[model samples]
Target: MRLNIHTLIHPTIQKLAYEIIYQKSHKKLQNTDNEKTLGMLIFYEILRKWLKIDNIYIKKVDVLKERRLSNQLDKYLIITNIIECYNILADVQRILPEPYLKHIDFNNINNSFYCNEKLQEYRIIIFEKFLKNYGIIEIINYLQKNNQINLNHVKIICLTCNSNILKYLANKYPQLNIYTIKIN
Candidate 1:
């Protein structure tokens, strides 16, 4: 399975996830079991709220079963949940068509600025498209920098909190090399 945290979240769920943790701890970024729990909860909430998927829960996933059996010794087991969720989403698409719904592939490029000289020209245009795709109007309440996205600013980079954005943009614009600095 692709070990990515991007496609696993949407902006609304992200706010809810953070709020779930914020109520428990003041420091938000502390990487602990609580943080992991919040992540799991967000995945569940996405299925429950966003997709109207109630019958399936995170506990039902086999990889999660393995993780629970092993007591989560390997943090990588978290990846299993995201993959399972994506599969669920794909199943939904096959069942009902949602307008403008972007099929997410976690492995796709999010937003990256390749310094390689050979890719410079292509990068310039792609970088611009990336900026537009993720500009303030798009992800303003999410990752858009302080209510303003300056494409003319030159130093354009995306540190995506969720990989779904990358997958959506890539699917929409296959020609442009979507770029992002992966956190993990």
Candidate 2:
């Protein structure tokens, strides 16, 4: 069962939607700095593209409109930023079993990070969707901020689609644990 990002009813998407709702209701997360709107737009845009009924659903919605609409599904949505989006993906990847991961197109998604507390390790996962030029810069910035993480315990995982950036990072930081996964 290959995971399709465009399909609303796909297991992966269903899981994502359920997680969003659960997180929203349980945590009472509110939108901040327009990030949530942008995230929601990006998310739904991907989900809406393949749906035949998408044409009939509300075409455009602003923050106020979205707030006012407050339909059942809308009420449960957990609005988030890019980092949160990455965190959500990491959570899903961690929660789902290995077999499910193989079928999901993780490479197509943007940047995300995962921390394995059991191993005391951190993984910075970069994808093709990330900005090619600034990807290394962003990672460097994150590393600088989170300096507590020992360099030995930090792993940089890059999709083969960003091989150039991976090569540069690996060469520049020889001590860093860098690995690449080729996605077809």
**Per-model CA lDDT versus the true structure:** 0.30, 0.34
Mark the 10 consecutive residues where model 1 has the least summed lDDT: 71-80
What would you estimate as the lDDT of candidate 2? 0.34
Q: Mind giving the per-residue lDDT tens digits that candidate 2 earns over 72-172? A: 22111111123434433343322212201111123332445332232212222222222235445454544545445444444333322244554555555
lDDT of 1 by residue, 110-136 (tens): 432112222211211111211223332
Model 1 TM-score, 2 decimals: 0.21
- The C-alpha RMSD of each candidate to the native structure, in angstroms, is 17.0, 18.2
Which segments of model 1 are wrong by more than 4 Å? 1-29, 49-184
State the displacement of the C-alpha of residue 71, model 2, in Å, after optimal TM-score superposition.
39
Best by lDDT: 2
